[model samples]
Target chain A: MSYFVSPIAYIVLLVFTVLSGVFFFIYLEGFAQVQFDTRAQLFQQSFSLTEFVLQPYFGTISVLLLLIIPMLTMRLLSEEKKQHTSELLFTSPITVINIVLGKYLAALALFILMLLFSSIFVIVLYLKGNPDPGVILSGFMGLFLIGASFLAVGLFASSLSQNQIVSAVISFGLLLLFWIIGASSDAETSVVGYLSIINHLDNFIKGVVEVKDLVYYISFIFIGLFLTHIVLDSQRWR
Target chain B: MIKVQNLTKKYGNIVAIDNISFQVNKGEILGFLGPNGAGKTTTMRMITGYMPASEGRVEVSGFDIADDPIAAKNEIGYLPENPPLYDDMKVTDFLDFVAGIKGVQEGRAAKIEDSMNKCGISDVKGRLIGNLSKGYRQRIGIAQAILNDPSVLVLDEPTIGLDPKQIIEIRELIKQLGSERTIILSTHILPEVMMTCSKVVIINKGRIVLETTLGELNEKLDGDNEIHLKLEKYSSDIKAKLSALQSVQNVNDLGSGEFIIKSRQRNNIGDEIARVVIDNNWGLKEIRPKLNTLEDVFLNVISSELKQ
Candidate 1:
């Protein structure tokens, strides 16, 4: 299908996959070289410094997902609406919900396929060195949640207008607000901190997939997609 | 069948279609005629649910445009003033996309073939829309609109910008399509309306100024025939002499030793005017009668209004 075969999707996938793989390798090398003194007897008798270095890896990947989701979703409805292909879509019996869902799924499917291809990094890590499989799976779970949440926000941005650039900018702006609020807040401002998508991924990076984090991601996706649906519906009125 | 009652469309304070009403029966071609800024396209857009009316309603095959837009849109096929086309898509792929969206539930390939064949763009189906000629592109546009085989077909300026031959071919195609389906076409080409539409509605300044059957519109302006006379001896007495004749309604000197005379009835004015010229010992260089035209009626109405 042209949807999967398009070079834009391939380029985004390659860039993100390589960058994350490089981060994973750097984290492993940093752990292997670091010399700890009394910290070795502080808590765990046998815990890999490699895993601790990779802790920030999942968080960094979450940030990468947020940064790149707009590239995948900016073209969904905006391109069709801009090119006037929307008339072909609108006059058909297909409802606005289906069009929105079809495009969203198409983008997500491409993203997931790319993620599958990058699982080679995980396999290589297991072959070359010993790492906890549970932590790896939990990191993947966090990646999926972060990707879906960002994609929903990007889709909502796409629904606002017929310009792909505008959609990408708005999606990035919205996600950056959430990421900054999640990182720089204390318990007193925990409300804003809890709203952070990266905050939800923090527990996952620590090999803990909390139900509350899952709910947060799902609710974020739901609200973003719900707003996209409303914006598309309002086009008929315009 | 379609009935638009008291249909008014306004963009804020500016009215686009003002209290317009018209009916299109089954299997008839209705021509919507108006000037550049007329409400013809606006009315069509409203009927197709591309836009909504500010007030009133349109019913297509008994389904209200606003109350039941999906059903009404399903029954009607619309080609807008500018064909909404995707340049990146191949002609066949574009038509397939249109068929998919138009909800052609069965025999989609066959229907697409039929539409392409009807529009005579089957040969260019493999080519991207941007690479096609203007005439072929227009055909693809029409092909997409008719892909679903809707009962009511609406076309706006379908033959616009086509060469003379292409225009005739498209006009003939529209006439053939009108035989089985109800058609509403808006065009500034008066002769195309005369040849294709069974009835016509003329609008001006966003208002329906006239609505009449084609035969009625033609007959209203029909004054039988006109005679052009060329005389070697030019004189003011010629007008008085032609006016006194039984069939002559009015005579105007063209200031070039020529005159145009309109007859009161649909009689052969060539022989009568020739006889009069010979009897008056006038050196008649030419005597020819012309039939009534839509242009004549249009100008007559506008000119009379200007005179008042």
Candidate 2:
């Protein structure tokens, strides 16, 4: 509720919703135009609703999340530090792990709320076209995993500093680092390529739920939360 | 109920608080008095386990803070210099959150109400904390601090930045709360200690300068009796005559028939001074013993330490 109360959260939500909606509509219109111009060719080719809509929708949502998740999480711990309210929590009976988990869960809850709103685009596609519900579910799952991973990293960034802008910048830099690492990897099948979060999400986008992809995202989330706990605990010593 | 043993805190090489130690018995209010940068806040933070000390131990209700932080923290309620408040949260909602986090599972509503009423913030329960005044916010801070009814309360400058009336009200509230739990309140204000605290520990330059009760402080100040006399008629010879007396060690004229006569020992020399005034016909209007204030003690201790 505290995060939702901030006007920045609403602004971020609105911008994300509008941008994704506009891009989804443009993609749908372009696809419709292509179908009209080459209806015979389109029918001959293997045209998939998942490829036409769900893929683009989930891909666009990931990019939007890269920008929006940091804003959602920057104030999680930074505001408490800035206002000197962290002292209350530090002195309370709660441990640093509890504080870190509590704030991370709150940010995750906000991310889930945003995901629910973005599902409107998927619902629209489901009604307008015969998209596979299974594919759509997998895509939604991938989007959620990526968003949660971003949120965890952003939460760790928030714990790093008392300045919200610094936290946001750090989170953005980290997410962008993970997003672009696979592109620079020499081999696509190499271990280095797996460092990129976007690489792992490819399987989920194609409606394939590989155990390796699940482990990648789950590890990312765990590492982010663990680092956050360490940072929060270190503050007590200083 | 609260015992701090040789609590020393250092930030890098800078000693924020030197080897300082004090104890607050159950139901006692210990005034943590100091000037700015005198390590009062650091000491309180160490006591509350908000931060760890470099080389000492703090025990609250027989639980060592460093070894058993959760158990010790559970026994304490702390209010930092600035109230730890969520400006976006309403008073009731904020207190409810605090109550929940503090693990007050049963009778939570009653506990919140009791704290709000005790801090005189029941009227602002429905208002946003951001919309409230500083005084009200401070009351809300106190309200949250007392929510769990901890055995010890640590307040860092509770009356700071408050108006006189608000300061008095908060002081009264602190006094009322101190009746049930041990409290350590830090403040740079002198008379606040004299008025509210039962005992005071004055710290200067990261060290404890004095730890004495208010009654003992008054008695100590009164022991060095100095008579202040104001007379209508001025006489140059009155000083010599007063100094010539057996009890008078020194007599200094403070201009316009006002004289300060220092006694050789702790004795009431008002009658002796009156006799001199009558004999010399100096028209004595006012004559009284000047009691040393907390300001005097504070300055004396601080300055003496600086000289050393």
Candidate 3:
């Protein structure tokens, strides 16, 4: 709640709303041009809006979320430390779990709210095009899972340093690494490919919901929060 | 009540505080007296459950801090050397947040109001904490500490970085609050302890040099004020002359016409030293009694502890 009152939250929200809106219109126009080009071809079969438009649209939104979630979470723990407010929190009757979970959930809540606003774009799609509700919903779920995992990582990174910028950089480095490292080859059974965060998302964007993907995200979130709890508790011991 | 026994803290090989023991009963304020870097803050941190001790234990209201930290911390309201404040937060909002975390449920609004009133920050309750003056910020820091009405209150240098009037006001506020709570206030300022505390614990270089009632500390401070004397000429014979005086207790030559004269507080030694200088044709260049430095007070406490 304190976070929502700050200007940074609104600023990040505005930037996200603008950037995702622009991405939606740009993708819609590109899909329309492709449809027109296909109309000139031999076959007059229509193109799937979910395939040519919202899929790519959600994909770009993921990238946009990746860039902005760090800003939302960089100060969660680092600002508490820098301002010495962690001392206040630690001395209170609160546990390390409470501290870690409270911050993660608050940032996650704001991210969810931000995701809700972009649903207007989905509403517009429903009005104009006959898109698959299941695919769009699956894509939204993937974004939610990815955002949750990213937020957890960002929260953990925030605990690693007292400087907000340093935490931001660390989370960015970690997230980008997770996104690009095991993406070298398309081998489906590669051990390293399983570690790639983006690999799980492809199945979700294609309207496939694998239980392994859900487990991966939930476990990722758990590990991130566990590491954060250890770091915060050890700060007291040190 | 707060009980800290054999409490020790170390950062790697550096012992921040040695094994220390002390307690503050209900309604008594314990002054943690020490110079800067003397581990006063470290001990207070341990007592408040902000930092875990490397060895030993702390118990508050029968809850061992090591065994049950949440209960122990629930009883303690700590104001660290730098007050933990959210600079961008409104004063009321910050206090509300603290009240929430401290779990003040019954009559929460009234309690917040009373704390703000006690700290005299009610006027600025709606203002941003970053915009307040140093005194107001300190007051707000103190307000948050007292908001929960915890059984134990730990304040470190509460009057530091304030003007003289603000210091006196804060001292009065502390005295008022000490009527019920067990308070441990750490500071390098000696007179602050004398003004607001019932007991004093003097620490020097991470070790407790002395622990006693403030009344006893007052006596030690009185008898240990040494008069520094500087004459215009060398003083081989002057040391004996000053030492032989009826009121003077001891004299030590500090080389090159300088001497330290000691005497009990009841004696009138200053005029006698001057009279002796005039009669013996010795020029009196400087004569000043040192009384206020924390080092001076610690020297007396350490001497008494050595005797013990």
Best by lDDT: 2
Candidate 2, superposed: residue stretches over 4 Å from native: A39-43, A185-187, B278-285
Model 1 off-target regions past 4 Å? A1-7, A10-57, A127-129, A187-189, B223-225, B230-246, B264-266, B276-287, B296-308
Query: What TM-score, to 2 decimal places, does chain A of model 2 have?
Result: 0.94
Q: What is the DockQ of each candidate?
A: 0.43, 0.73, 0.70
- Candidate 2 residues B206-243, lDDT tens each? 99999999888888667478989999988788888899
Error of 1 at B98 (Å): 2.3
> Candidates' lDDT values, in order?
0.80, 0.87, 0.86
lDDT of 3 at B268: 54
Give the per-residue lDDT of model 1 (tens digit) for B1-308.
Answer: 88999999887688878899999999899999887887887888888877778898899999998898788888988887767777767787778767767777699999999988888888988887877777887788788888888889989889986888878888888888888888999998888889999998888767777788988987775555777788998788887898888988888789867998988876777777888889999898877665667977766665564576
Model 3 gets an lDDT of 0.86
Lowest summed lDDT over 10 consecutive residues: which window, candidate 2 chain B?
A: B215-224
lDDT of 1 at B208: 76
User: How far does residue A4 in candidate 3 sit from its true spot (Å)?
Assistant: 1.2
Between candidates 1 and 3, the lDDT winner: 3
* Steric clash pairs (candidate 2): none
